[model samples]
Structures are given as C-alpha cells and as structure tokens.
Target: MTPTSEAELAELISAATTPFAIRGGGTRVLNADDGPILDTTGMSGISLYEPGALTVVAGSGTPVQEIANALKAENQRLAFEPPNLNDALGTSGESTIGGVAASNASGPRRIAVGACRDFMLGVRFVDGAGNIVKNGGRVMKNVTGYDLVKLMSSAHGTLGVLSEVSLKVLPNVEFQVSLRLADLSAQQAIDAMSSALGSPFEVSGAARDADGSVLLRFEGFEASVRYRAESLMKNLAAFGAIEQIEDQETCEALWSDIRDARAFAKGQGDLWRISVKPSDAPEFLEQVQPSKTLLDWGGGLIWAELPSGTDIRAKMTVAGHATLMRAGTDNFAKLGRFHPEPTPLAKISADLRARFDPKGLFNPGLMGDLS
Candidate 1:
C-alpha cells in the first residue's frame, strides 16, 4: 500500500489485518520477505523551511538530496551530516529524510555536532495501531514529557511510520581544513585523535583509515581554521610529520569518502558499525581483527569489514554492540545483524516494543526477537 497522505496512511494502517513492511525510498539494509509493503515514496516535498530559524519541516518521503539542495541554497545544513548509502548499499532509490531519521544515520561530523537524533526537533508518525503521534517542538527548547523524537530514531521503523519530521539545521562553517598525520599505527592514530579531540582546537572530524593514516578536521572562520590547523600540527608533532589539507576541493572529497564508507562499497566483506567508548576502541580492535577497518568518531565508532561467514560477536570482548551494516543474504542470515543486549536490557527493549506495537507487526524481529 502506498500512502500519499497521513490521513490515508492512518486509515490504511487501521484497516490492515495482516503485517506490513514499512518502506521509505527503500534504500536501506532491509529484508523483503517480512510482509506486504507500505511505501511512503508517494508522499514527498518540503512543507515548511524557516532558514532564518534554522529549521525545516519536510514530508517523510522527501528525498534527502532535495533537502540538501534547499539547505545549500541558504548556507545551512544538517549538522550531524547524515550518510547517503546509495553506493554502499547498492540500492537505486534515493534515501529519504524520514528513512535517515529512522536509521539515525550519522557521518564523520557526528563527532562534532552530535547525531541525527540530536538535530531532530519534532516528528509526526503513525504508530503500529494507526494513531498519529507528535512529539517535541520546532525549536531547541523542547522540554516536555518523553523524548519520543529520539526514541523513534534508530528504531528502524519498529515502532511507527514517520510521516513528517521537523529538524534543527545549522549554518555552514566559513572555512574548513584537515590535518593528515601519516605513518602512524592504529593505536598511535587513536592516541592522536583522542588528544586532538580532548584539546580546545575544535576538531570537527577524526578518523583512522585501514592504512594507519589519521585525519583531523577543523572548521571556523578562515583565520581561525588556519591557526588551529597549525597549532594542532604543533601539538601533534610527536605523532609524526603532519600534512595540511586546506584545499577546499581536496578536503571535501576526502571527507565525503569517509562519510559514505566508500572504502566498504560493493564487493567488500560484511560491514559492521561498532560503537564503543572512544578510549576502548584500541583494545576492541585487537580482539575482532577484521580484514579492513575504518576508525571514526574519534575512536568511538569503528567501521569494520570482516570476511564473509565470520561471526563478529564471537570475537567481541568489548562493551559495545556490533551492527551488521552491509552483507549478503546468506551472511546476514548466518550471523545475526544487531547485537543482542543482556537479559535485563533485552526485557526493557521488548517491553517498549510491546507497548508501541503489541502485534509485533512493524519490522518484526529484525532488531532482535521483540516478538
């Protein structure tokens, strides 16, 4: 069923007796055999954009590229830098705003301004029972009741179908620069990234590629960005000779690669997005030992690409969940996708799903057996 309007969507949901798989742009890591599909692509376009207020309200199926173009015209952007997995996922449909929110997809700059959930101000969604629910406000001072806007995010449509979302935008930085510290090992790169992040240089992006090269980004006015770049180089002198990447085109291209996980595009092994305490990454990497990896989010997020048929959890000794981001059907079925939480936490998650979707109809069991 394709829903072109919220009212129509609610009516469809209210009338349906069988389970339905939710779809928005249909470009995510999804399994198609769940149930009848409810596609939201029929509903598209930005409803309201208050650039002066740094806010935008768009229909759930509005293409992310469309919103990005609109924001670029006003020198504003989604601060969290949501990822576009078109290439990585090998999916043709463009990612939608609602889809991005539902997955809480964040890129390299997530280390700076936070995540997709952090910028979400308000949301309009239809729950499993077909009831329209709205939470939060258009501005940052929303301090009432539960923060369902955040709860719905990263839920992968297990709770509701987002019809509309209002997000807090941010102004573009006047200038930006990256410092590439080469010839360092993984641990040394993490150490440099940690030190840079802990310092007052305002490092906006940090990552260590599989080849052991580290990158640190700074953004602000031209003068400030340059000063910080030089100062950061001096501070990180112990690591190695630092190379400055002030060429706007070069910096943008490199970051775009890291942001999109271009290294793990197609033909790569199964990809996992692991989140752990930034300081604990070095220890975790020593255990999992993936074939290729990308250390990002100042070491808090580790994008590991392991060989096929490998069980990531078996090698995991750290205190973090491993998300099976990309893999073939056989691999996905063999190795569970999401990390199964401890018994206590699993019960809490199960209870939340039951409260929102008693029938276990929304993307049932993909995030774990909430059913």
Candidate 2:
C-alpha cells in the first residue's frame, strides 16, 4: 500500500492484519529475519528545518545522507553520528533517517556526545491500532510525559511505523586530530584509552584496529584540539610510539571506516558485538580467540568476526552484553542481559506489546517473542 499521509499509513497497517516488516531503502533487510514487508520509501521528504532552534523535522523515509548534507550546509550535525551500515555490510542502498533511528546506529562520537535516542525530540507514527499518534515535540525541553520518542530509537519497527521525526543538532566542530599509537598489546592499549578518558583532555573517539594499533581522536576548536592532542601524546608515551595524523582528508576517511567497522566486514563469519567491562577486554579476548577483532568504545564494544559456522554465543556469554550482528540462522546470538527476566518492568513491556500489537503484526521475532 502506498501511504501518502499518516492517516493512510494507519489505514494500511490496520487492514494488513498480519506480521509485517517495515522497509526503508531495504538496506539491511537481507540480514533481517523474514516476514511480510511494508516499504516506507514512498513516504519521504523534509518537513521543517529550524536552524536557529537547532532542530529538523523530516519524513521517516528520508535518506540519511541527504539529512547529513543538509545539516552540513548550516554548519550543524547530528550529535549521534549514525554509522554507515551499507559500507560495513558490503551492500548498496540509501540508508534512511528512520532506519538509523530504528537501528539506533551510533558511531565513535557516541562515547562523548550521545546515542541516537538522546538526540531524538519527537516522532509521529502509526501505531498497531491503526491510530496516528504523536509523541514528544519539536522543542528540546518539552518533557511533559513518557519520552516515547526516545523509546522508539532501537525498536526496529517492531512497536510502530515511523512517519516523521524531530531531532536535536549540534554545531559542527572546526577541526579534528587523530593520535595513533602503534604496537601496543590489547590490554595496554585499552589501559591508555581509559587513562585518556579520565584526563582533562576531551577525546571524542578511541579504538584499537585489527593490527592492535590504537587510534584516538580529539575534536573541537583548533587551539583546544592542538593543546589536548599534545598533552595526550605526552601522557600516553609509555604505551608505544605515537604519531599525529593531521591530514584532513585522510583523517575523515579513516574515522568513517572505523565508525562503521569496515575492516572486519571482508572476512565472512558470524559477526558478534560484545559489550564488556573495559578492564575485562583482555580476558574476553582470551576466551573468544577470534580470528579478527576491533575494540571500540574504549574496550566496551568488541567487534569480533568469528570463523564461519562458529558458535559465538557461548563465548559471548562471558561478556556482560552480546548481540549476534550477522548470522546464517534466525537464533542470532544468545544474549545474556537482554533475555526476559521475572520482574515488574518485564510485565510492563509485555502489557505494552499486547496493547500495541495484540496479534504480533510487526517484526514478531526481532526482539524475541512478546509471549
């Protein structure tokens, strides 16, 4: 059904009466579990742009690159830099703004700034009951009730079909500098990263590549960045030889790949995103012994691509949080923290599911069965 308006979208949803997966440019759909699909690409355009207020409202299906480019023209940017999943997944499609919110795709900047949910101000969507519901608002400080806009960040179209979104934007920084440390052991690198985080220096991004080389980024006013980079280099000298990457084009290209986990994409396997304590990284790596691994979020997020057909879930259980990023089958990774618990909050989530989609008409197994 081609929905020209929210009302039409609601009508279409109500009439379907079957489990349907929402599609935006269909970028990551192939990796998604199978179900009836509802394409939202037809519902695309920007509705409002308040540069002074640092907010923009756009159709749910609007391309992410389009929004990024538009924001760049005004010297503003999405605080939560959404990852380029297309490049990481080795596929081509326009990743929609809605998809980024739905997936809660975040990059290195997430460590300092925020996640997609934090910047989300409001959303207009068609709920499972065939009703067009609006939550939050265009203004940043309008917190009058439950923040449903934030709740929908990583919902992946399971709760409702997004129609429009309003988000907070930040002023673009003038300069960026990357400090590279070579030949440090994984544990040593993570130690240095943690030390930098505690310092007065403002480090925006920190990660260890497959070669065990650590990269740190500082972004802000040119003078501040320069001062911070020099201080950080002096403090982290014990780790290894340090080199400053000052080339603008090269810096952008390098961070762009790091943001999306491009290096681990080539070797095909069951990809797992393991979130462990920064201090537990060395022990976690010893357990998995993955063929390739990239540590990000200062060792909190460990990107590991295991050998094909490996049972990564068992290794992931050692860590606190784990998600099977790419899998050949439906079960994905057996998560430790995300599993259903016998608690009041679990009951509330169950009730909300029943209210929204009694028949489970949206992405039934994506977040595990409601029942």
Please report the candidate that would top lDDT against the real structure: 1
**Each candidate: RMSD to true structure?**
1.4, 2.3
Q: What's the lDDT for all of these models?
A: 0.85, 0.80
Residue-wise C-alpha lDDT for candidate 2, range 324-348, written one tens digit per residue: 6665554343332133434676677
lDDT of 1 at 299: 86
TM-score of each: 0.96, 0.93
lDDT accuracy of residue 93 in candidate 1: 83
Error of 2 at 222 (Å): 0.5
The TM-score obtained by model 1 is 0.96
